[model samples]
Target chain A: TQLLEQSPQFLSIQEGENLTVYCNSSSVFSSLQWYRQEPGEGPVLLVTVVTGGEVKKLKRLTFQFGDARKDSSLHITAAQPGDTGLYLCAAPSYNTDKLIFGTGTRLQVFP
Target chain B: SAVISQKPSRDICQRGTSLTIQCQVDSQVTMMFWYRQQPGQSLTLIATANQGSEATYESGFVIDKFPISRPNLTFSTLTVSNMSPEDSSIYLCSVSGTSAYNEQFFGPGTRLTVL
Candidate 1:
């Protein structure tokens, strides 16, 4: 079974602080995605990285796919209280449309 | 992107009871996925629902416990039978986009609390 492990299962930081969350897996994936989920809501797509060593930026958030396609990372610059939520990394299953999600990193940006 | 909606946004039910959650997508989709998110945990894929076919469940999940129905391309239902305290979680419905890269779009999610 393929699994994606996330570093720092929980994080609590002051507003304006920057943080990085890593997602690593022993198996390679065709594509990787990042999602942010707020309380009482499903996760929202943040970005998708398909190529090895690919980097995509969305405003204050930057996402990178590792050179081997077995890892990814999400970095938030100057996080705000609004950024507090659960961040998850997911990859598509081989020969299937299903997605395998990481354990997740819960971020709490307190003011 | 498709607009997805789940019925019974939140429900509180007694243990041993059953609940069926409905998911509707604005646009027709080829594949619909059901996921479970335990409190303070990431989403785990429960099964994949396809129109006119038996739903494919992931390992550790069985068809008897989680029955899924996909009568059409735009609608599906998932029933949690004989629920217990461990069944309390957020159930989310999602669909993969038709583009080259299959990006998933999710519904607001149905929060289930078994008492």
Candidate 2:
């Protein structure tokens, strides 16, 4: 079984601060995805990284896949209150439609 | 991108009773997935619903407890049987895109509370 563990289960930061969340695993994956979910709503896909050592940025947010495809990271710059939510990293199961999600990192940005 | 919607956005039911959640997609999809997210936890896939076929459940889930029906490409339903307090969670419906990336899109989610 492949398990994904995230660092700093809870994060609280002031407005304009920067933060980075990490997702690590021992098993390789064909693809990796990042999602952000708000309270009482389903998660929305932020980005998908399919290549090793690949980095994609969305405005102030940056996502990077590990060189070995066994880990990924999400970095947010100038964090605002609107960026507060539960961030999750997911990987597809081998030859299956299932998605294995990470432990999750809850971010709270206070103004 | 496909738009997905789930019925009964939130429900409070008594233990031992059952509740059925409906998922509808704006466009036809080859596969629809059901997932459960307990309070303060990440999402766990319940089953994968395919058109005209029996749903494939995950390791910890079963067909009897969580029966899924996919009558067509754009719709599916999931029933939670013999509910308990532990069964309270948010149920989400998702579908994979037909693009090369196959990114999954999610519904608004249905929150179920077993009393």
Candidate 3:
């Protein structure tokens, strides 16, 4: 079984601060995705990293896939109140057609 | 990416009753997935809805409890049958692009509250 563990399950930071969330797993994956979900809503895909050691950025948010494809990271720079939400990492199964999601990190960026 | 919509954004139902949530995607998608998210917990995949074939459920989930149907490439439904208080959660439907590895777009989600 492949499981993704996310560190710092909950985080509270003031505006302009920066923070990073980590997602680690024992099994390698072909691709990994990051999502941000607000209350009473489904997660919206932020980015997908397929190549190992790849880094992608969306405005102030940056996502990185580990060199081994077994870990990933999401970093938010100069956080704002709008950045407050739940961050999730998901890796689609290689042999099967399913997505394994990480534990998730709930971030609160206060103004 | 696709724009997906789900019906009954939030509902309150009695235990032992059932509720069927509908999912519609803007574009045709090959794969649709159902998921459940309990309070303060991560998402858990319930099943994969196939266009023409029967839905494939994951462990700890059965068709008898949560029946899913995908009649076409752009739509699907998930029925929570014989619900209990524990079944109260946010149900989301997701659709993958052309390939399984493609990024998935999710619906707004149906928040079910079983009394």
Best by DockQ: 1
Top candidate, metric lDDT: 1
In order, candidate lDDTs are 0.94, 0.93, 0.91
User: How good is model 1 by TM-score?
Assistant: 0.97
Q: Candidate 3 vs. truth: CA RMSD?
A: 1.2
iRMS for all predictions? Answer: 1.0, 1.4, 1.3
Q: What are the clashing pairs of model 3?
A: none
The reply for model 2, stretches above 4 Å from the true place, is none
Q: lDDT tens digits, residues A19-106, model 1? A: 9999999999999999999998888989999999999999999999999999999999999999999999999878877788999999
Task: State residue A97's C-alpha deviation in candidate 1, in Å.
Answer: 1.1
Query: Which docking class does model 1 fall in?
Result: medium
TM-score of 3: 0.96
Q: Candidate 1 regions off by >4 Å?
A: none
Q: Which docking class does model 3 fall in?
A: medium
State how far residue A99 of model 1 sits from its true place (Å).
Answer: 0.8
As for candidate 1, its clashing pairs are: none
User: TM-score of each candidate?
Assistant: 0.97, 0.97, 0.96
Worst 10 residues of 1 chain B by lDDT: B96-105
Alpha-carbon error at B23 in model 2, in Å?
0.3
Tens digits of lDDT, candidate 3, A1-111: 889999899999999999999999999999999989998788998888999999999999999999999999998899999998899999987677778899999999888
The 10-residue segment with the lowest total lDDT in model 3 chain A:
A91-100
